[model samples]
Target chain A: MDNKRRKFLKMAGATVLAGIGAPAVVKLTSVPALASGSEQAAAGHGSGHGEEQRTGIRLGMVIDMRKFYGNEELLNQAIAACHAVHNVPEIPGRKSEIKWIWKTGFANAFVAQSQNLRSETVKNSQFPVLCNHCDNPSCVKVCPTKATFVNEKNGIVAMDYHRCIGCRFCMAACPFGARSFNWQDPRPFIKTYNPDFPSRMRGVVEKCNFCAERLALGLEPACVEACQGTGAMVFGDLNDPQSEVRKVLSEEFTIQRNAAAGTRPSVFYIV
Target chain B: MIEKTLKGKPAYWIWLAILGTFIAIGWACYFRQYVFGLGLTGMSRDVSWGLYISQFTFLVGVAAGGLMLVLPYYIHNYKAFGRITILGEFLAISALVMCLMFIMADLGQPLRGLNVIFHPTPQSMLFWDMCVLWGYLLLNVLCGWVILTAERKQVPPPKWIYFFVAISIPFAVSIHTVTAMLYCGLPGRHFWLSAIIAPRFLASAFAAGPSLILLACLVMRKYAHFDAGKEAIQKMTTIIMYAVIINTFFFLLEFFVGYYSEVPGHIHSLEYLFFGLEHDGHVYNNLVPFMWTAALFNFTGLGILAYMKIAKVFDYRLVGTAATLIFLALWADKGLGFVFAGFVPNPLEEVTEYIPTLNELGITLGIWATGFFLLTLLYKIAVGIEHEVEA
Candidate 1:
């Protein structure tokens, strides 16, 4: 009986070791290959041409609230342009709303920056808030699948809707409340279908993708285009000192939504 | 051994039938949720996780609580716990099944549940949670079945079983710790951001888990004609006493840090839960009564337990009452209070109150029923085998 127990222990030990070690070995060997494959896929999908792919560029936005202050129409136009292009639903209730770009009061927009003694105009103003596309995005960090990931080449936080398990950990992790889940089939709510962009299904999380498709086609984001000439919204590489976004940042005193969150938001607001 | 579950008294079958009906109703509600999307639940964009996740969190503790028995019995060779160690393992098994079921029910795309495993991202705490939960489940199932089978054959479980037993000790701890990490690691959620969340989880888990085991033992004694032994019950009761005390202390620590520090982020959720937050003149205090009730039950249960321990009284009825109270207190504290409060005064600092829909409650009840159904079968088998061995 003792000998039999010893043999059984040996077999069990071997099986246990094999079970754990096998996965580790497979993960280690396959990781590099998978990483490269995903990068290539991202590059291919992000920009049709390799030359157009903005490498080493931290894509960011400068929402010059100075230009947008008291002009709710421009804010509405920007929201409409982005939502129309992205096929975001017009779900009425706040419970099942899907928004890529939206407007909120200054206090709601910048909880950390809002002061009790702020000027009436500043206090009353509404700000456009979207995904910050943070350099240290909490959403990406908590995503179980690499469904939502930072575009390493350009620093634009991106999403792969198909891969998303819709666990909403990202939604919880995101300090900005930028991400939205499709609580219902969003297709029925889309008033005018935009065939250019595919509508998300009921069980995926989506947010501002920084208009990766338009960027692929060598065009500015729809929101930026809609706000063109008004110069309310500037979309450019934050890495390039000469870029309009950087120029705006240099000239204006700007702040990020919840900078205290330590997400290092790419989107800045000039209050 | 498997056949033991097939033989049961009429009451046993009736109990199972009732559980089956709840399970059926829950399945029907879940089908509605799956068809219409998660819109059926009270969760909004702000409050993304709701009752399902809350139950998942609490059940993880209940599952981990099983370790209280396993560690003392196998590692320390506490012979009093010998007869009831399998009970702990079996309880853990059923609790984990409920945990997994809750997760599945909560998922937006249930079909894509395997995506976490298929593309494992180590950075995601959820991936680690999934890993640990599944690992713990497998370990318990293996250990419980092997040990129970050996006991049935009137032979010692092979020495090799000790290896799995040893692993499951930490595996049990890891399951709850990892589950805590899921909430605590998030950046902006102030309620879950505290360092003590993991320790508090273990404390409550230890309390809740053993309280449940004691209750089960009581039931088994009366109905199933199985006694877990007086010494074993006494030891377990003592463990619960300390555990409940520690759990309450940990919560007080959180309350002190939140209130004394005067951080709005920290205090808002707690205030919302207990006293109700005054937002724009209207007090959003839906959870206030529930929170106070939990507190009352917790303190009252602690009082009873302390009295019993100090007075050296092992009155079964009093012990049973204390156990039930402690279990319910911990359930409300960890389940409803913890998860819901975290989402309140959301990251945007907006109050979007979430009240689970009737369908949602139906689904929640169903999952719990499914868990009890599993527990009944597993315990029936274990007790039946023990009875046969004695006969």
Candidate 2:
């Protein structure tokens, strides 16, 4: 090849190499900064409440079905408390509804455990279901953008509304049907907007965060606090054996929703 | 040269105008969808994916189907296909363009689409799908354009072009396979959780893709006076025939597994799709007619193609009809039947049937028109060049 041609080839090759390498280097350097930025955002949201940020905590919830079994009013109150605090919209239809926590028949809740000749109590009772914050959360596994993620600092399955692309891949992956998408603008539907929590925009997925913000503020989840005196809903650190959740889990004959799914849900029901 | 597309006949201009009108309407509908949100569509919380995603899945098959032509001609040294390999590559380019548009339309935060690139989670199947699809599109455009340019100049393509062509062969397979893995790897969606999904996707794509190419070739032969050789068309028909049989067989395997296992999780979605699941004394059977129609068309098309192969008499009219039937059948099967069926009983065992609204349909039609518009332009250029070479 002529010298001019060879020189042109070398320049083109270098240009191609630089084109491929430049973005990669930038992405690698930015990843840690982005991660820390998200961590700081998580911390900053819960920081001003004067509670020390806790780490090495696997937050868990236990619902004693015995207390909640026949109490429809109490269950509704618990659901209301969570929704009211979190600014979850009260959309009218099943299609566009944003539900953080909701009640369903026991058979529907625990499909595997339901027997053909089950007692009327088990069949008639309503179970309040929420995000299990599974140790192996399938939602987190499928999130292409890591918008919905398991908080490493505390095992709360959380949503970064700003980051969510609304692909709903997480919704398909979540065995529990815990995630809800903002199919439309959610603000108009919120009758009473809680200033403390941010309402999501249209085209993003939102779900129960196990009240990660509340937990950071040294407070129990809204649902757990709603049923505080009744001992129906218990929220605490599962990593701490002395914590109420672990104590209750150890003592009670508890079952998880779709245990066979192998997601290892942190939420359990005392049957 | 692309300039060839600019000076087409009145029919071509009229066709372009028609496509432009549909594209305009689709864009307007998409604007409404953007403003109103995905709630404007039939998709609910239960059926999170509907027409947009279904079309994306189907078109991915169409895009990958280009491999049927590329593989045989390049790997097997089939000289007959030499006349029309560019057509296959260009077809792939158009289909992939539609595939990407459908994905963009399906997203909730379409603007945040860059987040997929920004985050780059290797664990997510969607990430790999994005990678493979973009790579395949690039490879096809490069291979098709470079080769066609070389052919136009009456010279052999550069040695480097063959390297890219080889990469594109496997790259085509990966696009559809990765798309399948998007559904199959998910936990608890039993309808999509099978090992056969990738194979099934490939089988249907092979049938659908070449069926489209066959139809296009017949059209060009009649109108543009461009012939892709009789032997090449016959061989393609045989390939489509076997592909249709294999596609049907793979689907049946899914049925056998679902029915024989007696696993409610496995059977429920299939039942909901085909026979309508009864819930609260109301049967959800919206997709039943469509699925059955797909079955009918698929079998009928298969029979016709089989007859054509056996008789050794290729009638252009009959071939065109069979190709259309098979194309529509695969579209209904992969596009309509496959996607929402996975979401039918949902993860919670609740049945919520999806029926796309007018806005959704309009947008879908628009994307398809856009693809065809691109296809027409590309074919015009290719056929124009071929005519020049003949002259």
Query: What's candidate 1's DockQ score?
Result: 0.55
Badly placed stretches (over 4 Å) of model 1 are A1-55
Question: Could you give the DockQ of candidate 2?
Answer: 0.57
Across B182-204, the per-residue lDDT of candidate 2 in tens digits comes to 99988778899999999999999
After TM-score superposition, the amount by which residue B5's alpha carbon in candidate 1 deviates from its true location, in angstroms, is 0.7
Query: What are the root-mean-square deviations of the candidates from the true structure over C-alphas?
Result: 13.4, 13.4
In angstroms, how far off is B153's CA in candidate 1?
1.4
Error of 2 at B341 (Å): 0.7
lDDT tens digits, residues A69-166, model 2?
77888999999999999999999989899999999887678876755887788788888988889877888888999988877656788899999999
**Which residue pairs does candidate 1 place in steric collision?**
none
Please, what is the TM-score per model?
0.92, 0.91
- What lDDT does the true structure give each of the candidates? 0.86, 0.85
